[model samples]
Target: MIALTSPLLWYTARASGIVSLLLLTAVMALGVMTATRVGGRPMPRFAVAEVHRRIALMTMIFLVLHILTTVLDTYVHIGLLAALIPFTSAYKTVWVAFGSVAFDLLLAVTIASLLKQRISHAAWRAIHWLSYVSFPIAIIHVLMIGTDTRFPWMLLLVAGCVGTLFLAIAWRLWAHPRPDGALTAVPRRKGRPGTTATASTQHAPRGRKIASSGQTRKPR
Candidate 1:
C-alpha cells in the first residue's frame, strides 16, 4: 500500500506551482516589453532587460521547488524520474507530461541564455523561441491538474496572466510592425529646387565641413 504523507507537503507543492505561474507570467510580459524597447529614459532598455532576467530566474527557482515538493509528497505516485520524464507519472499522466515537457523546454531556454555569448546568435534565438511554446503548455498543465483551478480566484488569475501577455504582444506588433523591429523612418522634407532635404539634412548647422564636386566646401 502507498504510504500517506503530511498535508503540508501537498500545500507547499500547490503554493510553489501557483507562485511559479505568476512569476512566469511576469517574465513573459517583461520579455515582450524588453524586445520592443518599451522603457523610456527613466527605466532605460537595459534596466527592463535586467528585470526580465531576474524574474525569469525566480520563476525557475519556484518551478524547481514545485517539482521537488510534488515528488516528495507521497499522496501521489510521482517520483523523481516522473518529474523529469513526460507521461511517466501514474497520477494525471497527460497533465503531468505537459508540465514535464514545459520544464524541458524551459531548461533548454535557460541553458541557451547562459551560454548566449558562446553560441551562434541564430541558435540562441531558435532555442529562445521554445519559451513561447513552453509558457502555454505550462498554463495548460496548471489548469488540467491543479486542485485550485476549481476556485474562481485561480481561474481569474490565469485569465489575467494570459491577458497581460497578449496585450504586450499586441503592443509590440502595433509599434514595431516589422520583423526586424526597427523604428520607422521619418518623412522626408522638401528643400530648394534642385536639392533634397531630410530630417537630418534640414537640421544641419551652417559652415559644417563637406566635399562637393571634389572640392572642400561648407553648408550655406
Candidate 2:
C-alpha cells in the first residue's frame, strides 16, 4: 500500500488519468459527429458511435480509479471533500476547480445515460446534450490543472481534439448533398406512342372499344 503512495506511483496515476480523459474526449466528439444529421444524410457507421460511447464509459472508470489513488497518496494533500467541491483544494484552487466542475458534469451525464430507459425520452435527450458541455469543460480542466500542460505530449493531445472535430465537420458536409428541386417531374415528349389522349382509346380491349361517334362497339 505504501508503494501506491510513493511519488513515482502518483506520477503514474496522473499520467494514466490524463490519457484516459483524452480518450474519453475523443470518443465523445466522435459520438457528436455521428449523431448529427444534416439534410438527411447520417454518418456511415453505427458501430463508430457505439465504440465511442463504450470507450468513454471505460475512460470514466479509469478516471475514478485515478482520482482515488491520487487522493490516497500521502505526498499529495488533496481532501475527499475537495475532490467533490470546486475551488476548495489547498493547492491550485482556481485551476483545480475546473476539474471539479468537469467531474460533476461527467458524473451527471454518466448517471443519466445509465438510467435512460427509466427516464422520459425528452428528459434523457436534454441531459444527453450535456455531453457536449462536459467535453469542453474536461478540456479546460486538463489544460489548466494538468501538471504536464507545457509538455510536447500535452500539445499533441490538444491538437488531436481540434483535428478530429475538423475532420468530422468536413466529412459531414461532403456526405450529405441536397438537391435544389430541379428534377421533381420528368416531362413527357410529343408524338410518343402512348403520349396523347387518343392513346387510351387505341389501347382499349377489342370487346370494350368505343366507336368514333362515342358509342361502345360490339365484339365481332
Candidate 3:
C-alpha cells in the first residue's frame, strides 16, 4: 500500500546510477591519459591527473546516492548488508552481488588512495588494480539487472561505454613513451658521421689572466 510517488525514488536511483557510470568513464579515461602523460593544448598532464581525482570523487558521491536510494525505496527490498556484502540480497541476487563486489573494490581503492603516503607504492598499486576489474563488473551488473536494458537508448548507452573503455585501453597500451618521457638524445640521419661540430662551445673566454695585446709571446 505505497504511495504513487514512490516511483521517484526508483527514478532517482536510476539517474544517479547512470551519472555515476558516466563519471566513472571519465575517471578511467583520465587515468589512462595520466599514465600516458598526454593532454590537450589547454589541459596539461598535471591537470589531467587532477581532473581524474576530482571525477573519481564525484563518481563516489553519485554511487553513494544510487546505493542509498535503491535501499531506501520501498519497491524493492535491498538491505544495508546487501550493499556491503555480496550475494546476500534476495532481489536480483546475482546482479546485486556483482554491484556489491564493485562497491567493495571501490572502497579499497578509495582507502588506499587516501592512505597513499602511508602505504608502500606496490601495495597501493595492487589495490588500485581492482578498479579496472570493477568497472567491467559494474557494467555487467547493470546489464543483468534488467532495469533499463529494455529501452533502445539504454542499450546504446551501454554500448557506448563499452566502446569508449576498450578504445581508451587500446590507446593506453599502444602509445610508447621515451625513457623518463624525455627525448635527450639528438637524432641524426643514416649517413651521419661519428660526430658533427656544433656552432656552440662550452669553453669560457680566457680573459682575466690573459696577457695584454702588446705582450710578447713566450716560447713553450
Sort order, TM-score high to low: 1, 3, 2
Runs of candidate 1 exceeding 4 Å displacement: 1-4, 177-220
Tens-digit lDDT track of model 2 for 55-77:
87887887777677767876767
Write the residue-wise lDDT of candidate 3 on 1-220 in tens digits. 4423388889999999998888888898888777776654567566788899999999999999999999889687888888779999999899999999988899899999999999999999999888999999999988998489889999899888888988988977776642233111232233323222322111113312223332222223
Off by over 4 Å in 2: 1-4, 37-44, 169-220
Q: Indicate which candidate wins on TM-score.
A: 1
Please give, for residues 103-220, the per-residue lDDT of candidate 1 as tens digits.
9999999999999999999999999889899999999999999999999999999999889988888888776733322222333455454343432332333534334422222444
Return the TM-score for candidate 3, rounded to 2 decimals.
0.78
Model 2: clashing residue pairs? none
Better of 2 and 3 by lDDT: 3
Q: Return the number of clashes found in candidate 3.
A: 0
lDDT of each: 0.82, 0.66, 0.78
Give the runs in model 3 whose Cα sits over 4 Å from its true position: 1-5, 177-220
Candidate with better TM-score, 1 vs 2: 1
